[model samples]
Target chain A: MKTKLIITTGAALLFAAGVLANAQRDAIVASLASQAGVSSFNADAGRAMFLGNFTGGKEATPSCTSCHTNNPQAQGRTRVGKVIEPMAVSRNPERFTDPEKVEKWFRRNCTSVLGRECTAEEKGNFLAFMISQ
Target chain B: MKKLTTLVSAAALTVASLPALGASPWMVENNTTKSECSDCHMAYAPGFLPERSWLAIMNNLSDHFGEDASLGDAARQEISNYLVAVAPKELRGVSSIAVPLRITDLRWFRGEHGSRLRNRAENNPNIGTMSNCTGCHRGAERGFFDDD
Candidate 1:
């Protein structure tokens, strides 16, 4: 009985910690979204960055939607140019969080598509729009 | 004996400095004016971009959307080298942009981009991940929209 109680207590603590962290993240996202003024992603940003829509990643380049769809609950792109899997909030088990990763890809994708850094506000807004989804 | 000792000590110092000297030369040339390419991008996407991405960006400056944001061939190459040379490890601390989910990583991007879509929707090169491809597309650069 004592052991059972201890395990339950431990689980509760872990759960509480998780909740706290999540709450903190949501708050941050909300603030960032509010500041960015991004109502919805519309995946317009992605199309602008993709090679397809731009037809600019060289004549052979592709677009952002070339891989990841309007709904991120899907897969992303690869190095050589191929589909991988789905990663939308519902599809991909644990997604979101990590400014660094977001920054890295935004940087890479923007360059891959746009050929330049996206700007923090743009990133923040993009992020907010994403989380809202 | 004393002279030899000094010589050895000097040699040791040089060896230690080798690591620093061995680094890519661009890191040493990091100047505000040099990275001017970041004027607009500094706020858009700071240290997140890697060298490869930077190189690609600089290379595409000419047709950078419809703005003719072209760079001199040499300058473009230099910027590309610098980005890869100085970029740090990815630090994903939040989930999505708003919340740092218990897990942090652009899984949404990864999940959506399973493979490269090669089909052309009409004349436009139809891609899978539109959001991931804006920065340079004419349609997107002209208007902040990446959805297919």
Candidate 2:
């Protein structure tokens, strides 16, 4: 009887945590969509952007995959060998929770990989893809 | 009498050289500085450079070593203050006019790491760059770097 009660409580807590994380992600995605004047974000489009190679950016970093790796679920390494946490929402629950951090990385990485700031639509799509992962 | 004097002098020399044999440890104390600066690289010990160098580095975060590492105003100010507070007043062989941006550029660093060791770091895939201090010094995060 005690074991059952403990398990039920643990499961409830886990579900609550998941719901909170999802709510945070939804808010961020919604803000991006409003900025882009879009109804919805496409995860497929985001995946393409993540994998696509571009000529405009620095030669060393042609795609997001150059540093983030093709698999968003796996850990990536920086050019200088620093370990980047997994980008998948499932793998890293804290990914993209902060507005400031999301904006900062997008501004820096988009400039490095795409030679420009990511459009609001692109940012939304990227988040959608990671969420799906 | 001559033998006794020589032995005493040798013991004194060993005592004096003890401090020189071990490198001083420098740990990051500020939580903001540790987390923010360590996002891309290790939050390097502020003592590695002087006050002017820290100020210069903090002022140019947007183009930090060719990457845009710009921080919000509040974070930038906090980190800058912490770094300046703990950095050494003077470093050996560094001139007052010099504002070194890279720790590797310091004369002491160059003397400590020779070309042969540098070549190995460049060539080895496991240790891609010399900036990855933990690649060789396993205890780098804990403020230890004596291991060679």
Candidate 3:
């Protein structure tokens, strides 16, 4: 009975931790949405941007899908042929946990894809889409 | 009997020199360098480039090969110092013409690879680029670049 109780408690803790991590990412997205003067995030718009093609950025990588692939849940490849972890929080729970890393990628990838930094609203929407994925 | 013994000794000598052949792999094992560099690409052996090349690459993280690879100041300095220390002696103090930043751009690398490289790029999906060393050298992470 004691061993069974311990195992159940351990499983519950792991589940709670996963929920907490997700909540933390949602809080960041919500905060960014407010900063962008938006009341809600639009995952559809985010998906469009993720798949959108543009001529503004570098010719080699005109869309996020150029490197990230069309499917957020699937593994992606860098231009240098390096493997990138999947972006979907479901597929890669460790992603979006580090605020600094999250921001740095946003700053770099947004400029690479859009030729400029992403607005907070855009980031929030993007995060929403990834979370949904 | 004497000839057979000599032949065996010669074979042993050749085997001993196997690891010495080709590029010397990374000697430094800094976790910070490995995690940061390998995140985007292979944690390339620092010995591949000269100290000057490492310095140039480290200093220009924001524009690293048209990608943003900027690291925190402390982490960047640590990796730079580690790379500089472990760079091959022959590569150190070399003239600018001899110290091209890209490993593929190095004259010796071109000479060594020659036509085989082009054939691999054209035919081998895993070897889509010369930068993908591990495609052929499966033991690349351990600094082993022996032919597959």
Q: Which DockQ-derived CAPRI band holds candidate 1?
A: incorrect
Candidate 3 clashing pairs, residues 3+ apart or interchain: none
TM-score of chain B of each: 0.35, 0.81, 0.72
**Model 1, span B1-148: residue lDDT tens:** 9999999999989767543344432223344324544322221232444334445556666554333345445655655555555543343432232422111134544454443432231224333323334322434322332555
DockQ, model 2, C-alpha based: 0.39
RMSD of each: 16.5, 9.5, 9.8
**Candidate 2 error regions (>4 Å):** A55-59, B1-25
lDDT (C-alpha, whole model) for all candidates = 0.46, 0.86, 0.79
Question: What interface RMSD does candidate 1 have?
Answer: 10.8
TM-score of chain B for predicted candidate 3 = 0.72
Top lDDT: which candidate number? 2
Model 1 ranges with Cα > 4 A deviation: A1-21, A24-28, A38-52, A56-61, A67-71, A74-77, A80-86, A91-94, A114-133, B20-148
| Candidates by DockQ, descending order | 2, 3, 1
How far does residue A42 in candidate 2 sit from its true spot (Å)?
2.0
Question: Count of backbone clashes for each model?
Answer: 96, 0, 0
- Winner by TM-score between candidate 3 and candidate 2: 2
Q: What is the lDDT of residue B104 in candidate 1?
A: 11
Question: Where in model 3 is the C-alpha error above 4 Å?
Answer: A1-10, B1-25, B89-97, B121-123
